[model samples]
Target: MQITGYKSQGVAAAVDLVNAVTTVEGDASFAALREILRVNGFFWHEFEERDAEPLRRWGRTLREFFDAAELETAVSLLNELMLELPMHPHLADHDPHGLHLHFAPPTARLPHRFRASTLMQLSELVVQHGLGRTGTCAAEGCDRVYADTSRAGRRRFCSEACANRTNVAAFRARRRTPRTPEGTG
Candidate 1:
């Protein structure tokens, strides 16, 4: 389903947070993260000399800290926790872009803004659809989470690549496993 700029930002921000946690133990470069953040309109351009403090001070390797298992646990927690946040209108024109709510203004410290905006978005979703809609990718070995905006509610992977890879792996595993004779243990 289609979403507006404000709604998209909320989803993008949540996806970004999920990306940070999921990539904690896997191979996802900052550029890749940037791309994902931008997917639904959460911009992450490189500023020549913008104060790096807020961005860097987040301290830990956001992605590398949460393993796949931990990432799943976090998704569940976030899904529930996000329900408690309130969506207040903090609309403003910060960029050359048109008017929009800050949700959590971009000018704020990167980490704080990210967390607040993301939570706001998830909170919005929770109020609208409840916790059953937001979820982690169903594919094993993938910790990616999506807001599941699909009309049919059938999304299972963060992307087609993960879905295809998972299916292929399953097919190979079945081929490799030894088969027993009929009625044999």
Candidate 2:
């Protein structure tokens, strides 16, 4: 399934938050959190000091969602969140991105809006591609998560660095292992 930039940002933002909160201990500082929002189109000015801890906690919750081993488990988690978060989905023509779906009403607090956006984006992802587009990083010792937003959907690592690190390790390991004689039975 093709993922538009509109859907991808929220999902990518969720992944970024999860990695910030989980992959690096003590990394989800307010400034760092605000930058995540800015990078994802949430706008740093929209961020409040009060929003940090909640976004951190939400990041942890989303990590659980990405870590789920079964479709039923992931769906159940999302359903529980949907029951809790207020979502007022509507059409909007907004600055930057024009004519797109807005998951939260304009009056909602930024944290609430962030929650609503990430939740609905994830729900849409599950609907379109199940668990195929999200995963834990394949690199050993890495706890980061990733959401594949590209049309190819072939991603297995959270970043290009992780991909290169893992690939280099695999290549070196193969080179070090003794190859059996071609005629050996």
Q: What CA RMSD would you report for each candidate?
A: 6.1, 1.4
Model 1: lDDT to the true structure: 0.54
Candidate 2 TM-score, true structure as reference: 0.95
Which ranges in model 1 have alpha carbons more than 4 Å from their true place? 1-5, 24-40, 46-89, 93-97, 105-107, 166-185
Q: Rate the local accuracy (lDDT) of all candidates.
A: 0.54, 0.88
Q: Give the alpha carbon lDDT tens digit for every residue of 1-185 in model 1.
A: 23445565766555555565344443345554555455645556642224233333221222222222444454565555445433344777756557766655445544455555655555555455554555566788677666665556566677798889998999999999999989988
TM-score of 1: 0.56
* Candidate 2 lDDT, 1-185, residue by residue in tens: 34577778899889889999987543799999998999999857989898899999999899989998899999999999999987889898888788888889988889888999899888889898889889898999888899887778889998899999999999999999999999995
